[model samples]
Target: MEKFPGAEEWVPARGGLPKVAERLKDCRGCDLWEDAEQVVPGDGPAKARMMLVGEQPGDVEDKEGQVFVGPAGRLLDKALEAAGITRDSVYITNAVKHFRFERRGKRRIHKTPAVGHIVACGPWLAREREIVKPELVVVLGAVAARALLGTGFKVTEHRGEPVELPDGTAAVATVHPSSVVRSEEYRRDFGLFVDDLRAAGALLA
Candidate 1:
């Protein structure tokens, strides 16, 4: 199976945020657990007001077993700062918890999680939402949008706009920080990215 059948099997009986993470540490939800150093579970408060979801871990994140500690994460921090959002104000996690990669020579290049992987990893996200119950869920990049919104959702068409989730919580779609890093127009794209964060922040008031 590309994705795990569900995250429930990995969930602890207590089902607290910490237990969720502890259980996830041993998750074999999908084959991703086979290669990664560890499962990169969500990081932040148990009841954070906002939750940020990215696609998957990058090179640095995979090694560190943290969701956002690398370049893209640093960039995301800047965008959040520019938008008046503090690091403590949001819970951050990846839509897929593992790093899927392909090795070339000495480098392990990041590979996008396939649709089946996304579907497989759906349970952890649901578990995170159940635990945090955030007022807003920010979807960064197409992969997250696909997992939370639907496969048909596109960040380009929906960026900076708030949409209602099936659970009724407000969710917003935006580009991943990696996209801005890759953009030729870093300044321009970063500005737009910050704008999207601001929109998400505005709803907090």
Candidate 2:
């Protein structure tokens, strides 16, 4: 197996996110890259005005090598449509590029990447932001919120409110679609989640 180039030694040679991502194909900044079948990079038009950031790849996503193509992804698609946003119009990615998990029999349990892991992966996330330079960023859950805004940022307190980053970009926090699906009260939360997505969509409009 080919090892990822060390983060310290890796430098992006081009100006686009895709180009940067190509370089990350050999990324070994963290151990997550080792077990992951492949790194899932953000996908969408280069000029998209909105960027959606999720926590990390799930089982199906890891296997498919795409962002948000699983159950949570389906929910996201529905929510985006309800919000009057086309999935193809915005960029979608994760805080962590690789999927981290524990194997339980035949199933792969999703594990949240650690702070150090997220920090190690920050450069890639930052590069995506720089390349896309979206007008607004929607953080899908706590992990993305922490990755983008630092550990001090709390999703509960700051969710639904837009915060300005140092780069002058605006960001809004919201629960991940998976959370809604996991809840016993899916109907209520799903409505709220769609509403939040609509709100985020409106910002771009």
Candidate 3:
């Protein structure tokens, strides 16, 4: 077993979004960066009322160096609209900054990031949260939920529920938009996803 030094040292002691984004490019936090095309940092306003945290950058995001611009992201935009939230208003990022994938011929299939990868990239996420200071954090899927909550946290058991973070910010756990995209019952699953987002939105009231 190998030990990771983590991203703590790579993180700026105190800086705004631009500084963090600039420094993030040079991070050798974990092995994920070795195969990834580039780091996908959080996007949107520096300060937002809500923050959407996903698992990691997907294939499109990895290549484009942006967060949530792929199919799942498009689905998320629709879901957010359905939930009465605007896409541009919230900060969007991932628990892991780099894309983790396995190659098949020329296509790269998405792979769930290992725990080490998540741990290594936590500092970056923390800095984003500090800079954004969002009143609410919406975690998309098991990975994001576990990253902010705990390894024992179960998204299935608590999806759509408002939970408390260590910093006292509210958090909502829901299935990732990619899951809805891959579902056989797309309409039904998407409806449920929108419902979860609505629940999260209600907390803002």
TM-score of every model?
Answer: 0.96, 0.93, 0.97
Per-residue C-alpha lDDT of model 1 across residues 1-205, encoded as one tens digit per residue: 3545656587665567788778888877678889887888789988899999999998899899788998999999999999999988789999899999999998999999998888888888888888889999999999999888886788899899989877789988999999998899999999999999999999887
Q: Candidate 2 on 54-153: residue-level lDDT in tens?
A: 9999989889988999999999999899888999999999988899999999888999888777877777888888888899999999889888887788
Residue 112 shift from truth in candidate 2, angstroms: 0.7
lDDT over C-alpha atoms for residue 129 of model 3? 94
Q: What is the lDDT of residue 129 in candidate 1?
A: 89
- Kindly report which residue stretches of model 2 are placed more than 4 angstroms away from their true locations once superposed: 1-8, 11-13
Sort by lDDT, top down from the best: 3, 1, 2
TM-score, prediction 1: 0.96
In angstroms, the error of model 3 at 124 is 0.5
Count the clashes in each prediction: 1, 1, 0
- How far off is residue 174 in model 3, in Å? 0.2
Error of 3 at 137 (Å): 0.4
Q: For model 2, what is the error of residue 5's alpha carbon versus the real structure, in angstroms, after optimal superposition?
A: 10
CA-RMSD of model 2 = 3.2
Winner by TM-score between candidate 3 and candidate 2: 3
